[model samples]
Target: MAETRIRIGIHQEVRHPYITHNLVGVTFSSLQVIHSPPTKMAETRIRIGILGCANIARKVSRAMLLSPNTTISAIGSRSLEKAIAFASENHFPESTKKYGSYEAVLDDPDVDAVYVPLPTSLHLRWAVLAAEKKKHVLLEKPVALDVGELDRILEACESSGVQFMDATMWMHHPRTAKMKEVLSDPHRFGQLKSVHSTFSYVGEGDFLQNDIRVNPSLDSLGVLGDAGWYSIRAILWAYDYELPKTVTAIGDPEYNESGVILSCGASLNWKENGKVATFYCSFYTNLTMDITVLGTKGSLRVHDFVIPFNENVGPFYAVANSRWKELSLGCEPEPSEFKITTVLPQEALMVQEFGRLVQGINGGEAKPEKKWPTISRKTQAVIDAVVASIKNGFKPVEVVY
Candidate 1:
């Protein structure tokens, strides 16, 4: 097939599904669809905007480029020069407009969706503003940095009839699906008794000084926000939506210096059945992400949670440990070990999946499932409990709702 020329500022009429006659705080009067093949003769595509020129934006923008149906229409930064420079350096040749502030991107009539990579503190403010502008939102992790804030943003999206997602990239990755499959083998693993997962990497000097990981208000919850979120999500998916009855956390008393819990260990007791699970997360350790699940019949161990492709660095897995650990108790365990098979980079898959979902909703192909909101809300509640546990001297905090 011949390549189609793609251009910016070319309004490709796109249709939205079962359009609401009216949405609160949002003017959908201009909502319409571009049925004609993109004018310059390119394939159908959605125009995306970025709220800032942060490094994470670099990854997301790259993923946008990878998607044939998405384009980086514009970018807004605190500085005009920085914005333009970022767009240019990132090779966003298609309608690469730059703005002096985030509001510019939010107000841009041509930008269909906005990717907000701002700090945790600014997530809700910018997300609500973007949604109000009738633009879909792809926000950075820890969605709101807190439960109250996340709830507010969620409310804004629902009220405005806008699509929004927390940029928890791994949630959209194919590896997670594969992980789920392996975890579902109840006959092989029997029952899940515990889950211990971790994610940590050394930070650059300046990053250590200013990273949100070290911000007190941002870390009010603890390392659970920084790394435990992924573990929680993974465990939940592994257990087929099974939730713990209670979750209690322990953090270093010097949480301020550590920002959030620089490190944390959590205990999760399953509801009704009383199955117990444990997790640990920290920012003050060498790079590592390993999750071990202890079951009645056997066990499953995943070496890396964030990115499984690093299997070369032992980012592999093991199963049925006793099969190989009979003679020596401390001997290395035996389990199924394999390498990543052409996995899509996490960020790229997330953007592509998000873009596809946004386009699907816009095209009336699918309804945004209720599960998304539940996942985000429940995740925040878990983090909230982590905070309570830390404040109460590692006391176990129960999971509510």
Candidate 2:
């Protein structure tokens, strides 16, 4: 058979002798052959607009830059000076636009999506507005003060036909996927029996009294919304987003003068499966983030589930079918550490994935994905239950959703 060659993008055409007559219509190159259109055609990269100059936005901005399919198109804040400073400090591209107000970024025709890193109280307003403007929204975690607020944001996104995702960076980490696989295996993990999660960080001096998280108006739920959000989401993820039957707030929650929670813990019970989970979140403890899942046949433990100690790789421990030694001094099968490495950090992967979805919509090949919003809703629902439990004198509150 005569060698066949096909050109894609600006790459030079190369002969593929191994490509058969049946593959003539397919695109081929010296290295490999792909049954698709030419690559030279310009593909749309999702242009992301940052809604605020919050501390978290700095990390996310770097992620957007690292993502191959996304770009930091613009950034806006109430103060133009702050926006300019944030952009400059984050090393935003020279071509990146800056605005005095978030609305301006939303109105920009070039911005295809918006990353809302605003305070929890402002999410409902800005997130909905971004959706109404036909821009995809990547909202920060603790998506809202309550499930109702989250529902409102979701409704707007659904009505406007745009994608919605919470900024749960760890969810996009390769280690998380691998951990899920292990937990789902029947022989390896059996049925999940219980789970315990904790996330906390000590807030010193001004942070304890003046940080937005402790400020009632800015973040009413306080540490529950900031730190507990991760713990609750981790538990929910382990249960595959299944709502528990009841949530009971653990003994006396510590609160600041403004009645904002500074520390709290909760227990979730799933009556149907007899599964139980507990989580503790605080802003007054040593920095720690842990998740331990126990199953009938195995167990898994992760010390840094929220932010990895190292960006290049995340480590987790897992053990199965253990037996005690003769003196009960140790176990027969010891836990082994597994490290999942990535070229880009989890946050960058998150931006890349969100951008990929937006690109699909831009190409008219697919609609916005619903999995993200669904998970976000479930997390918010659990949070609502926990809050209700605390409000009702630490009584158990049934999870309606």
Candidate 3:
């Protein structure tokens, strides 16, 4: 095979999924930055109040600062001192308020929106309350433990006419849009056939022993919520948010002593289109985040779908309509790599999008985008089906809308 007909991908600088690593907001790689086209910034920046001092907040706080249409107005933790320290350590503006209780931040009239990165158990309570308080909600993924809980949050936001968007950062990345465009093209990518995703990371020392993700009291969903959520979201995104007809737990899932899931896999069947999807998520495996989608004409593969190794550029490989060479030594038209560059990390883009939605609502210019909550509900619904299948000894559980 000719060298030009060979395919390869370069991956580097993988980081711990939970811990903070990349801090520089300006540059991503040695490659020159390719900026997005200029656009008008919102006239009014949304004031954001963060709930809890979770480690994830450290990265998101920086994102809010980088977003031109959003600002962190307050941060709250169980301990006022911790909140204050978090504010100081994260370099929040001096005027950003620190609250001892999450409710206090919700009560603050100045805060236009709240970013809820609290544990899964607390999402329903805090997210609903934020909506009732007229504060827009930017919720973390696994929006709720199940569809029932998610419905309540969505209902509250609908009742109050407040915007609700889950913090699935990768969905906001430019690369995601590019991939969607490719998959939607009938010529380049024919009918979608299958999607397989794997998201796992090694949890060393304190994480496995004390992390809320493994604690049933705080995050009963465990790795299913922490890492699996991303994989599930990716699968659903590739399927264009269509709910699977049935879901079956594929392998023997692992659980901690507390009965929290540590590792799991499931296969989903779409009856109408005859499409199938499978995903694996684990906390005990080597670091890997991959998503592969196959179609009649082409396939797309992304190694770092959950969190791109680089902050600025996201890369995916694709191959379409290939044929064997004369001697069948190798195929013609090797896979091509596509890179989408961004001025800010995907998290910052999420914050900016949320802020823009809130700004439009406040100005009476646009209504909330129902697509966000709709997709979130569908994701949780499939998760519920997967759990049920596992409990039923790997039986096929029908996904109820």
Off by over 4 Å in 2: 1-42
Candidate 2 lDDT tens digits, 111-219: 9999999999999999999999999999998899998999999999999989999999999887788789779988778899899999999999899899889899988
For model 3, the run of ten residues with the poorest summed lDDT: 1-10
Instruction: Please say which candidate is ahead in TM-score: 1 or 2.
Output: 2
1 or 3: which has the higher TM-score?
3
lDDT of 3 by residue, 144-263 (tens): 888899999999999999999999999988788878977887777889999999999998999887999999999998998888889999999998998898999976898888899999
lDDT of 2 at 146: 93
TM for every model, in the order presented, reads 0.82, 0.90, 0.89
Q: Model 1, 1-401: lDDT tens per residue?
A: 12233343445332222222221122222223332332333234678899988887887898888765677878999999999899888888655778999998888777878998887778878998888888888887777777788888888877877677777776664445545554566655666676777776666577656876677655444566767788776666666666677887745533445555566777777765547666777666788877777777666677666765442222345354354456655544445453333234667667765666676666666655456667877777777777778778888878776
Q: Which stretches in model 1 have alpha-carbon errors above 4 Å?
A: 1-43, 217-222, 251-260, 309-315, 324-333
lDDT of 1 at 213: 65
